[model samples]
Target: MPNSKPRANSLIELHKPKRASSVALVVPLKDASRECLKRLARYECPSLPPYPKSQAAAVLVGLFVGRWGDIYVLLSRRSATLSSYAGDTALPGGRWDKTDASLEDTAASFAETARFIQIGLPIDKRRVPLLCTLPPFLARSHLIVTPVVVLVTDPTLRPILNAPEVDTLFSHPLASFLHDRAPFPLPSSSPYHDMPWGPTRVRLHSFLTGREASGTKPIAGLTASILLEVAQIGYGIAPEGFEADAPGQASRRERIAWELSRAERFVEALKREGIRYDWTKEERREREKRLGRDKSRL
Candidate 1:
């Protein structure tokens, strides 16, 4: 009798990957990619390509076209073993080392980042061009994460998880972030205002994804925010329900400036607010616990 066994890659095989047939089919994606580049170019100034006062970081936003003309973006769940931002969805880059002779050399150092994202796909440089970058975001760890968008035209690609840095690799519809209702199959919601970062807050989104029934943790926080801007520009539309920024919210550049210029004052205020210099999110946890306790009164 012949043995009948399921393949080890059975889970990945279950979901049909979206692919493009020809150049004509990818026009929507190409057009959107061009739109992102054009919109970002408008903000070009001397102060741009914002390098953080803290350690410089970056996240690669990989965009590609699917079969039916929808734009998709690459995302990954951070490894559970990670010390920070673990379980959250994220882009495929990280804190780039800035210890170099010149800013140009610093850019050269980022060539090393390919090692971080060199998963089983065997990315071809000809097909994947590192193109425009979106505005920088100031992370809780004090790193200024520049959002770099890249267009992937190659359809003959399959990605495997780069364990340690990533737990699972997934793709989400890039344009869906601009929609009021998230087009995810799994349960999803927008702007879950659970926590406030110091005095400011950003629009947070969450989606349940992956093969599991319960769903992954969430695509919330910085990752979601980055995609929102991408979708807004890429599709030339604003998010439906909520405004992008709250009133009096300090821009990421402004926040970074304050952090750098008033290092002593910032540290003291953060410490008083339980945002330790070590960057522990103590206030967030405490707020959750307090909310839980308050619910008991009802």
Candidate 2:
């Protein structure tokens, strides 16, 4: 008859030989294997931008990636009471000053703006990495802007906004902009005040898209073009058709177009203030070149 009762330790020992306690036990072997597989499957590519000439003026391009794994780009809506780009959406950066040790330092200074505005937000100053600097860009204000790229890991960090400099804070998810079906048409008129692809947009685009895109429409300026470039990178798409604009080739009209599309309210406000603006032939040629057009007329 088969035995029904449970076997004692002695009975189990009789069936198997005891191993030395010195034998190491391997635990979570499957988990370790999975980790190895993940590591083997993942790859990284270095993205670098050409360095711009040493300049007094510069801009900061802050990028934030949330816990949900979604990337969100931050921009500021200037107060209507300010002089330039008033009430328009722009990046949280400005011209570099003598006190700034480096472009990275200048970009990080934005944290002070947050403090002044009493937003009670803190930025992890350590995470700001200087990716690369593009050729210096001359804005309508005759200021050459050196754009710097930075990554923000903590999105919940509240920002202390400068009441006079920044009126409101805005953010847009990268996923929303990447959708192929979304209608991201260029604005019918100028969006912002004087900026076509405002500093924020331009920097964001450069980081997103490795190269620039051209042609007259809303999303034609450097900023939008850069965003498109970044999207291409995230999707691992080859930037075959994208072009890189030459320095001083961006046009004032293109800047105007970008501003109009991005923030019509700000543009209207500037017009109400009777600000003078114009687009010249040379400016158009320069802009076209910056949009990646060559000397050959297209």
Estimate TM-scores for all models.
Answer: 0.67, 0.45
The parts of candidate 2 lying over 4 Å away from their true place are 1-55, 101-123, 127-133, 175-180, 183-298
Candidate 2, residue 224: CA error in Å? 3.8
Q: Predict model 1's lDDT versus the native.
A: 0.55
Question: What's the true lDDT of residue 73 in model 2?
Answer: 58
Q: Which candidate ranks first by lDDT, i.e. highest?
A: 1
State the displacement of the C-alpha of residue 158, model 1, in Å, after optimal TM-score superposition. Answer: 2.3
Task: Write the residue-wise lDDT of candidate 1 on 1-298 in tens digits.
Answer: 1122312121111111321122211233244444444453343323432233235666777776565545678877778889987767778775655355543333323433454462443444435544455667767766667776655656776776778878877778776665546345324343445445454554455544443454456566778788887777656777666677654355565555545434564455454545323322433444455456557767
